[model samples]
Target: MLVQVNFLGEASGCYSGGMQSQSSQSNKARRRKEGLPAITPEAICDAAISLTKEKGLEGWSMRDLAAELDAYVRVIYYHVGDRDAVTSLVIERVLSEVAIPSAASGWRAWFDDLLRGLRDVMRRYPGVAKRFALVGPGGHAARAIAETGISLLREAGFGELSVPAFSLLLEQTCQFVAQEDDRDALPSLRKSAASEYAACAGVPGGMGDLSKSVAHATTSESSLRRYYDDSFDFFLRTVLDGLEVRLSNMRG
Candidate 1:
C-alpha cells in the first residue's frame, strides 16, 4: 500500500502519479532555487556605478552585471526597471561624492572649498563629468549643492531676490569646470584640426595665409594655459566682487 500526495496542482496516488507529481514539484523547486533575492534600488544603483567606473558606459550591460553578481537578469528589473534608471542613479551617486564644506568659515572660503572638492571628484571620474554635464544636475546632490549655494549667498548678505543669481553663478562655474575637463584633450584635437586645415589649405593657392593662422593658433600651449587660468581667476574674482557689493548694499 502506498500513500498519495498532491503538489503543484498535480495528483500522486501511486507509482506513476507519485513520479509525475514529484517531477512537477522538482521543477517548481528548481525554479524557486533559480530566483534571486530582492535587491533594493540603492544597491542596484551602487552596482551600476561600480560597473560604470570599471567598464565605462559603452561596456556596461545588464547581462554582465547579472553575471558579476550571480543574479538573474530579471533581478535587475525588480530594482532598476531600465537602463535609464541606472543612468540616473549613476549620476546621482557621482554627484553625491562631492562634499559641501562646512559653513563655519566665510562665504568665499566655504564656496572655494566646495568648488575645489567638486573639481577633485569630477576629475576622478571623467565619464561622470561628461555625462553629468549633459544631464544637467537635478538629483539629491544637485539640490543639496544648490541649497548650500543659496545659504552661502544669504549669509554673505544676498537678498532672497539674488539667490537665483548666485545659483546661476555656481552652476555656470560647474559647467566651466566640466568644459575645462574636456580641454585636457584639446591639444590633440587642435593638432588634428591643424593637420586637416593644412591639407585643405595647401590644395588652394591663396589659402596659405589661412594655413599660417591655423598653425599659429595651434602652436601656443603656454598662452592657452595662461589664458585659461587668468580667465578663471578673473571670473571668480569678478563674481566675488559683485557679491561684496551686494553685501555692502545690504549692510547700509
Candidate 2:
C-alpha cells in the first residue's frame, strides 16, 4: 500500500518528517492548472546546483532549496530524500563538468593539465573542493577519473604504488583549492592576516626576503589568487619530481 500524505501536517511539519501531498492526483491537477512545472529528482538536483553555485554547497539548507523551487520543504524530501542526497547529486553534476584530459600527454603533463582543470571547476562551487579533499569523490565520474589516473601512474612505473600516488596528487591539489575557498569566505580575516604579514617585512633588522615574498603574495586579492595558482603549480611540480625520483629508486 502507498503512504498517505497529510498535506495539512506538512504546513507546520519539520523538514525531515512529513510527506508532501504534491504527488496526490488532486494536487497534481491543481499544479497543472496553475502552470507549475512538475518536480522530479533532476529538477531538485538542478535547483540544488544553483544554490551551491551561489552560496556554496554547505551554505544552503533544505528550506532554502525549497524556496528556490517555490515548493514546500517536504517536496524536497519527497523527491530527493535529504540534504546529503541532494549534495551527492550536486557533486555528481559538478564532477561531470570537469573535462578529463587525454592521457597521451604523459603522466606528469596529464596531471598538470587535469589538476588545473579540476581546480578551476571545484573553485567555482566553493565548499566542493574541501569535500573532495576530505572525503574524496564518490560517484561514477570520480571513479572514471580515478581509473584513468591510476592507469597513468602504473604505466609511469609507479607499479603497485599507483593508487597512493594518485591519491596524494589529487588530495594535495584539492586541499590547496579548499584552503583558497576557506580564505575567500573570510575576507576580513584574510586582510588582517595579510596586513600583519606585510608589517613583518618592515620590522627592524628585517627578515627581508621571506617576509617580503609573503607580503607581496598576500597583500591584494589579485596577488593572492595568483599566489595560490603559482604556489599550487610549484607544489604539484615538486611532487611530480619527487615521484619521478621515487620511481627511479624502485627501478634500481
Candidate 3:
C-alpha cells in the first residue's frame, strides 16, 4: 500500500519556524493586497512538480519556481528550504502515483506489475528515474513498495538474498528507464546510432547472425514509442526469466 500525497492542496498546521519575521509579515501583507493566496510548503512543492513536468527535474531552478508562483526566490526558500528540499518533495509526489500490485499475485507477477507501472510514472518526469537509479528511492513514498517487495522475495525462498535481489531488480529497472529518458532527449543521436547499426549490418560477411538479430531494431518503419515499448518489454521478460533461473539454482 502507498501513501497518497496531496499535489495541489494546502498542508495542515502552522509554519514550524515559530514566528514570522517582519519581512515575512510584510510579504504576507503584500500578497493579501495583491489578492494572492498565502504560500505554504505544499504549494511551493506543487509548483516545483509542475516545473519539473515541463522542463525536467534538472532543467528548472529556484528562480524559475519563484517566477511560476509569482513570488520572490526567497519565498521559495522560506517555504521549502531550498531546491534540494523541493526536489525531494517532487520525487516523493511522483513516486506516490506508482501502482502497487497485490501480494496474492505471486512474486514474479507482483514485481512485473510494479516495475511496469514504475517505468511509466518515472518516464513522465525526466531525470527523476536516474536519481532513483543512483541514490535509490529515499522518501516515505517508496517505503511500502520496498517492504512488500522484500517480503515477497523472502516468501519465495530468497533467504538471506532477499534484500540484494530486490535491490538488483529495482536498480536495473530504473537504469533502463533512465536510459530511455536520455535517448528520448536526443532524437538525432538515436537516429545516427540506428543508421550506423544498419550500415554495419549491411557489410557482407561482417556481422553474420548478429546483423540479423539487430535488423528489426534498425528498421525505420516502427514509431519511436513503439520501439521503446517493444524493447522494454523484451528486456523486462529476459530479466525476469534470468531471476527465475537464479531462484531455481538457489532451491537446488
Candidate 4:
C-alpha cells in the first residue's frame, strides 16, 4: 500500500529545519529572563495539567498555558507542537497516577475500584477524561491499565481471546463517565437540556429530541458524583453475574 506524502506538512523531513531557521533561536531567547523559573518539558506538562484543571481541555489554549507559565506561546510551541501535544502529555501524567492494586479483590471488585479511581482522578483534574476520550491505549500508563484489566478478566475465567475486546468495552464505559465528568458545564447543561426537551415535547416531529437524552443525565453534583458510584455497582454486578453464568454453562 502506498501512502501520500505532503512535503509541506508536519512530518516532512525538512519541517524541523525550516522551523529552526525561522524562530527556534528567537523563541529560546524570549525565555532568557532573570529570576524566572526554568521551563522544562516536565514543568510544561505540570503547568498544562494545572491549566486544564482550572478550565478544561477545551477551556485552555496554548496561549493560556503560556501565560500561566509566564512564557511566550512560541516557547510552548518549542516544547510541544501545539495544544493537542500538551494535552497528550497531560493525559500521560493523569493515567500514570493510577496504580494497580498489589492483591486481587476478585475481578468485579478490582474493576469497580479501578473504574472509580480513574473517574475520581479525572474529576479532580477536570479535563483529563475529555482529553483521553480518544486516547486509546497509546501511552504506557493507559496500556498498563488495560493490561491489568485484561489479566483480571482472564483470571476470572473470561475467554482468553476476549480480554482485549473487553478492555475496549471497559474503556468506553469509563470514557462515558469521564466525558460527562464536566463538573462545570454539565450542571447548567443538565438543567437547560431538561427544560428544552420538555418544551420540545408535543411539538411537530421536526428534529430528533437529542436533549431528551442529555436531560436524563443527573443534574446535581451529588448525582453526578454517584453517576458511577450507585449505578456502576449495578453495572459491575450485572456483568459479573452474566460472566459467571457463561462460565458455569461452559463447565457443564
Candidate 5:
C-alpha cells in the first residue's frame, strides 16, 4: 500500500501527482495567450537590456521593462518565461554582437583581439556586464569564447591540458572587464545611490553631495583609457608567461 500525499489539493499518486502542476501551468499559459498582443522573446530581452542601461541592473524590474517596451508584464512572461531567462537572453544577444577575431591573426594575436572586443562590448553596455556577473557565462557568447580559446591553446601547442585552463582564463578576463567597466560607470551609480540614501537619511538634495564625491573619485576619461591599456597589456603578458613556462616544460 502506498500513501498519497495531497499537494495543493491534488492527489499525489506515482505519476499523476508530479505532472498535475505542470499540466495546470501549461493550461494557464494557453489561456493567458488568448487574444494577447504578441511580443517576441528578442523584443523582451532588448527592452530589458535597454532598461538596464538607463537604470542599473538593481534598478530594473519586469514592470519597468514592460513600461519601456510598452507591453504588458504578462507578455514578458509569455515570451521569456521570467526575469532570469530574460537576463540570460539579454547577455546572449549582446555577446552575439561581438565580432570574433579571425584565425589568420595567429593564436596569440587572435586571443588578444578577441578579448579586446569583449572588453569594448562590456564597456559599451555596463548594465549587461553587471547582470552577466550574477548570471555567469552561458549561451552563444560563452560557446564562441570556449571554442576560440581551445583553438588558440591548440595552436600554442598545449594539447588537451590547455583547454580547461584557457576557458577559466577567459572567464576571469570577462569578469575583470566587467569590473573595470563598472568602475567607469561609478559616478552615475554613486549619484543614484546617494539619492536613495539621502531619501532614507531624511536629507534634502543629498544627491548633490554624492555627485561631488563621485566626481572626485572618478578620474579623467583619458587617464582611465591609459589605465585600461596598461592593465590589459599586463594581463596578456602574464598569461603568455604562464603559457611559455608550460610549453618549455612540455618541450623538455
Candidate 6:
C-alpha cells in the first residue's frame, strides 16, 4: 500500500512537469494554431512585401517574417518555399505596379513614359531597386515587361536590333536607378569618390582628368541622383538614336 501511494505521487509529479514544459515551449519555432485564417501563398507574399518595404530586403529573415505573421517559420516555408521565393514575389509585386504605357504620342513618348514610370516605382520601394537589379526578376511580370519593351523597340524601327536594344534599356534603367535608391550608401560613396578623384587628379596613367572630375561630382546624394538621372536619360536617348543609326545603316 505504501509503495502504490508513492508511485501515484511520483506519476502525478512527472505529469505536472511534462505539462509545464509543453506550455513553456508552445511558442517556439513551429507552433501551430487551430484556426490561422487559411494561410495562402498570396497572404504570405503580402506580408513579405510589407516587411521588405519596412525593412530592406536583406534586413528581414524567415524567423522575423514568421514572427510578424504570428506563426512558425516553417509555416512560411510551406507557403512560399524560402527567402528567395519571397523576394521573387516581391519583385513581381513591384513590377506589376508599373504601368505599361501605350504608344499614344509615338514610340519615343511611350518609351519616355515607360522609363519614367519604372523610375517612379523603383524610387517608391527604396532598397527594392537594388535587390531587383541583383536578382534580375524571374517572375511573370519580368516577362511581360520585357515583351512590352521589345514591342516598343519594334515600333521605333529597331526591327532586327530590337532584342539588343530592349536588353540594354532594361539593364541600364534598372542598374542606374538601383544605385540611386541607396540613400545610406550615397554619403559614403560620395566621400570615397571625392577622395579617389583627388588622389587621381593630374596623375599621369590614371583615369583621365575629366572622368575623375565627373566621378567626384557624383558622390553626394543629391548630386548622385541628378547625375544618375541625367546619365540615364542621355543613355536612353543615345541608344534610341543608335537604333535609328542602325536602321540607316541597314537601309544604306
Q: Report the C-alpha displacement of residue 121, candidate 5, in angstroms.
A: 0.5
Please, what are the lDDT tens digits per residue for candidate 1 over residues 17-71? 4554565456446656888444556667767777776766435788887776556
TM-score of each: 0.58, 0.86, 0.85, 0.70, 0.67, 0.69
- Candidate 6, residues 70-133: lDDT per residue as tens digits? 7767555544566766777777788889998875676667777887789888776666777766
Model 5 clashing residue pairs (backbone): none
Worst 10 residues of 1 by lDDT: 3-12
For candidate 3, the per-residue lDDT at 202 reads 62
Residue 67 in candidate 4, Cα distance off native in Å:
1.3
Candidate 1 — what's its lDDT? 0.63
Model 4 stretches astray by more than 4 angstroms: 1-32, 182-184, 192-228
Model 2's lDDT to the true fold?
0.80
Model 4 is weakest, by summed lDDT over 10 consecutive residues, at: 1-10
lDDT of 5 at 6: 20
What lDDT tens digits, residue by residue, belong to model 2 across residues 157-183?
898899999999989998989898888
Per-residue alpha-carbon lDDT of candidate 4 for residues 118-236, written as tens digits (9 for 90 to 100): 76677767756655665553445477777677777777667764565465556655565565665356666667666777566555554345444334444455654565466666666
Worst 10 residues of 3 by lDDT: 1-10
Q: In angstroms, give how far residue 150 of model 3 lies from its true place.
A: 0.4
Q: lDDT at 128 for candidate 6?
A: 70
Runs of candidate 2 with Cα error greater than 4 angstroms are 1-27, 204-207
Writing each residue's lDDT as its tens digit, candidate 5 over 1-252 gives 122322111122343364545754665576567753345665666677787667656568888888876666755654455676676666776787788888887777777787778777776666666556566656454787678778778877888877766765666676777777566568687456545654444334665665554443334556546756777778877886777787879878
In model 5, what lDDT does residue 221 have? Answer: 58
